[model samples]
Target: MNTISAKYKKDFNMDKSIEEKLVIRNKRFQSRLMLGTGKYRNIKEAVESIEKSEASIITVAVRKIEYLKKIGKSNLIDFLDWNKLWLLPNTAGCQTAEEAVRLATLGIEMNKKLGQLENNFVKLEVISDSKYLLPDPIGTLKAAEYLVKRNFTVLPYIYPDPILAKQLEEIGCHTIMPLGSPIGSGQGLQNFYNIKVIIENTKVPIIVDAGIGQASEANAAMEIGASGILLNTAIAKSGQPKLMAEAMKLSVISGRKCYTSGIMTKQIQGQASSPYYGIPKLQ
Candidate 1:
């Protein structure tokens, strides 16, 4: 692996390296950057940011908005182009399996109403901790099992635990989203080693979600072999969300290129760029 890594590092190039596409639940996507439809200044800015990001998948928190919209209320879906993007409804505030399962069912119906023609894909976020907004692994596992049995493509947001990731994969989860840090903290890859293990071991796509502070952080995650990244705070909280979104787009591209091209291994001893025999001694 070290030798391969060295060769790849030597051959790395932004334009010359071949890039790998992301595939989730049998669906192929050109862009691996997934954005959340929350925390923007407004719907217009959110839409513009998403457009700039060029993300094919956007996660929407399923809550009262769907219920209100059923009665002809103005909701967020009205402002989005469902045809151009895939909506991944998440049980953002659900604290239990029952709640997540229920919301997921409602989310599927909502997607249908919005003209989604694909499988009912849901991002399972069972957050029992309101303080840190961390996921409840028990609730997430329970909800994932139920959703998979119901033929929904389950993607659980979880901690960076390889065992838990493998468990979710065994339960038929479409993808595994491990947090880089606490949700919305912008701490950026605090659990990098665990995430790298998850990416290496899991057959399913591993998407690093939450706690990415900047576009460079996103690039770092991608370079370490994460299949994709799902972020909102990094872009939404920036001074210029649109430009930040574009930076994120390029970051993902560059990071994926580096990953595909193979990064160089670190060494304790330094290697000389100029050969000793070729250099003339200074007078």
Candidate 2:
């Protein structure tokens, strides 16, 4: 298995020479992996994992941060270095378009407090389902349209629906984030076909968010032409969050390299790698 994998990689020339940048609106990022500051054992572990992941963009749940601030408690923002990381405040707990729009305003305030005075990036999520945690397309679209009109860089999290993805893009959304599966389910790209279609059809970045449980899954997402990935549970719930974070970072890079190098076409029958015309006759 190792030899075959090595040979395949060599044939594909999946090296680290390709230079690709993930551009969302005016912002450009070298690292395509985005991490979330939640579900960790503690703030220290979360910080360490994020550092190890080397993800330049980190998402924070706006509602949670607001709650912490109201209670006079330090939140994840207090520890993160804003100069090194860009805050992507998310509307995690919002169930309605109004609620999501309200939380997004709070996120702008939070960014200003963190010294990101000009930051307007938001991860729009309007989810009412507690069991599946699936995003509501109508609510998300409403919130996205409102936020975009307000000059916010909207990155709406939605189910892997190709049509909806294009709709958000048409409305001036910076990026379209389609879930791999249910949030925190770690099912790993259950909606692979839909996501692939979105990537093929969309002009903006297509980030695969949620349901990625391992580094390999992250790699697979990037390999399938996803512009980036936003994940949390896979690293936070791992026994060694820091190590897993690093693994995910490498996986994203490896996958991107593979994608740029060009993946081989699938074949039904095996073809001899060595030239059959040059074979010596055996007695």
Candidate 3:
């Protein structure tokens, strides 16, 4: 077992050497795993988990922060260190294009307060469906167009639809975040085929967002050529958020390395690792 483990470790190290940084909208990110600042039991746990994840880009729901401040409760921004982390403000709870645009505008102000003067990154989400939490395509497209016109680096979250992804890219979205499954369901890549198509067709980054419940799921998405991942519940709702975050970080790195190293093609029949012709005539 030790020998087998050592062999994998050596191979992974070689693969890691050729791994490239995840670039989105001209900004380079060393870690392809982007974490959300929600669902944790406490702020301390959330901060610790973010540290363990080693994710440079952190997504925060602008409405939640605003509500917390309005209620006189501590908000996520107060705890995060702006110097080390880049904020990806999201319009999570907005159900309409107008509402999403409004929240995105507020997010820009929030970023300005965080000392991100020129930062305009916004994760645009427009969902009217409460039960499934599925993004509304028409609303999302409308909001994305408005945001893009205002020069915001929009990263819209949507279902794994190849056509919509191309439209978003054409409209100047920095990245396309396709749901792996329903939000927080942990179903893990239910739309794997469509996502692959999106990755193949689009020129922008394809980030697998939501429904990734474990490290293996995260790895699977990255291995299939996803540019990055944005997950919250899998880490925040885990038994040990910190440990799970670390697992996710390593899994993203391993998956990216595998993709960059060029994974072996699938074969229908089993083949011997060693050449079969080297043996002498034997009884």
Off by over 4 Å in 1: 1-17, 67-73, 278-283
TM-score of each: 0.90, 0.92, 0.93
TM-score of 1: 0.90
> lDDT for model 3, on a 0 to 1 scale?
0.92
Cα RMSDs of all predictions?
5.2, 5.3, 4.8
Candidate 3 residue 78 C-alpha distance from true site, Å: 0.7
Worst 10 residues of 3 by lDDT: 11-20
Mark the regions of model 2 whose C-alpha exceeds 4 Å error after superposition: 1-17
| Candidate 3 local Cα displacement, residue 51, angstroms | 0.3
State, as a TM-score between 0 and 1, how close model 3 is to the true structure: 0.93
The RMSD (Cα, Å) of candidate 3 is: 4.8
Error at 62, model 1, angstroms: 1.3
Could you give candidate 3's per-residue lDDT for residues 1-283 as a string of tens digits?
4455764878756644456777887888788999998889999999999999999999999999999999999987798899889999999999999999999999999999999998899999999999999999999999999999989999999999999999999999989999999999989999999999999999899999999999999999999899999999999999999999999999988898888788898999997999878789787
Better of 1 and 2 by lDDT: 2
Model 3, residue pairs in steric clash: none
lDDT of 2 at 15: 50
